[model samples]
Target: MANKLIKQMGLPKSIANIFTARNIITAKDALSHTEFELMELLDVDKEEVTSAMAHVSEVVCPPCQTALLLLEQRVRNETLAGHLPTHLKGLDEALCGGIPFGVLTELVGPAGIGKTQFCLKLSLLASLPASCGGLDGRVIYIDIESKFRSKRLIEIGINSFPEIFLKKGMAQEMAGRILVLRPTSLSEFAESLYQIKVSLLQQQVKLLIIDSMAALVLGEHECGTSRQQALGVHVSFIKSLAEFSRIPVILTNQVRSQFGDESRMYSFQEPLYNKR
Candidate 1:
């Protein structure tokens, strides 16, 4: 029966033998060859391809494993990952260490905690020369709060690299790399963000900033069923896009109050109100 099932599933005889010995219930329960199905089987979310190689004998494929090895190498190459500073030395150092290449890092805090400043600083930082943090990469700044300030960025840029502004050629080059985007509505904002991400990658954008994500959510509607649903969609959209781009997505968020508990006297709320 196992032999018949294995033949039907088109698996190699040697691979099928291993399953048959374990008395594997059926081929239906085994891994699939489709891309999505293979992704599910590998549990790429729970564990990385590199970690899986630690126990190569346990995994099901030689060809698939080889493909994963190549994929893993590519990811490692792109990541060129770095560490977060121990002192939390503001945004410059925190990101100076490096933001996860293909992950969403939320900057949630109170009104005056420098969230916008961080985003602006990151844009300028990414635009700097090799001597600075720049990888010859550009930045895409999405202004949701209507608080995108050019003056503030200029101030930070001057502080971080006075020589650039002092030198017209360098300043012109750095200024050209930044792309400021302002979307009037939530839908427009989302569409623009998607396009900007795609476009920026072509220009080798290492950093993308969405200033005050909650503003767009709250601007469209108050916290309600519709708003909740929309926010969820936005979160998922950003997460997916972040993974695809393999670039740092620094998003600012707003805060809200929460009800207090019986045991704890303090009443705190989640600053970043996204469902996840």
Candidate 2:
């Protein structure tokens, strides 16, 4: 757009074309271009480059600013400011409040670490009212290892909502809240990815739990590198769901230890993002 503005003001076509081709479509780029650099590209002297810049400056417009006012009451809502607590005070405080919304949380550890149990508890808690440390929304648990305990959820519902259980149709209603899905294989898991997104809005889900992400990745019959690529794909899909729906997505996984480590070889809690 900056280049087009300069072109409309009578800059030569060849010169304007070079702006985009050289990745200098912005006025800032034009301003930063060295006299020697412009000489090479424009076949002009330093004086001509300076003259061209003055013309470019006139076309370079600053972005306009806008402001908004939000209601005081809406600022403190559960979906935005507040987090979905696990209902365990110690655990919740340790996590600096609770499991937050609108992002993916990956939990990695070996077996018998209660990853599945913790997820089950969170799913049950997520169905509770906001005053009870929940988002008051539905849960979708994608089970890859067939460890989804429906009985556990029912027991929790009974204890958590005993009064609700006393009423007719409430037990069945509570049972329907936490939807369990067991994808038999990684390929099958991939097929259900799209439908899960649709279910989030339709069912009004705000918390998603995937029990053991490793099962789907490691179960694939392919090279180790291929498994890594598959993991990337799975991460991308879940990330899209979290960001688009503005909900918390928790995924558990297992890690392997390398044998040939002489001294702290397999250690890493690296930053999630880095330059390639």
List, residue by residue over 1-276, the lDDT tens digit for candidate 2: 554544454666767776667666666667676778877876767786777777777567554543322322222332364566776789667554677666677776667788888887788777766665556789888988888877877776677667655578766665678888888888778777788999989988978988866677766645656776777777788888887888878888765543465321111113231100
Can you give the lDDT of residue 13 in candidate 1?
58
Q: TM-score of predicted model 1?
A: 0.63
Candidate 2 lDDT at 193 equals: 74
Per-residue lDDT, model 2, residue 134, is: 58
Q: Please list the C-alpha lDDT of all candidates, in the order they appear.
A: 0.61, 0.69
The per-residue C-alpha lDDT of model 2 at residue 162 equals 74
Show where candidate 1 strays beyond 4 Å: 1-96, 258-276
* lDDT for position 113 in model 1: 78
TM-score per model over all chains:
0.63, 0.69
- Which number leads on lDDT? 2
Candidate 2 Cα misplacement greater than 4 A, ranges = 1-37, 46-81, 158-169, 257-276
lDDT of 1 by residue, 12-95 (tens): 455455445645435434432333443355444434323322233233333444756765664465347532221235633434
Best by TM-score: 2
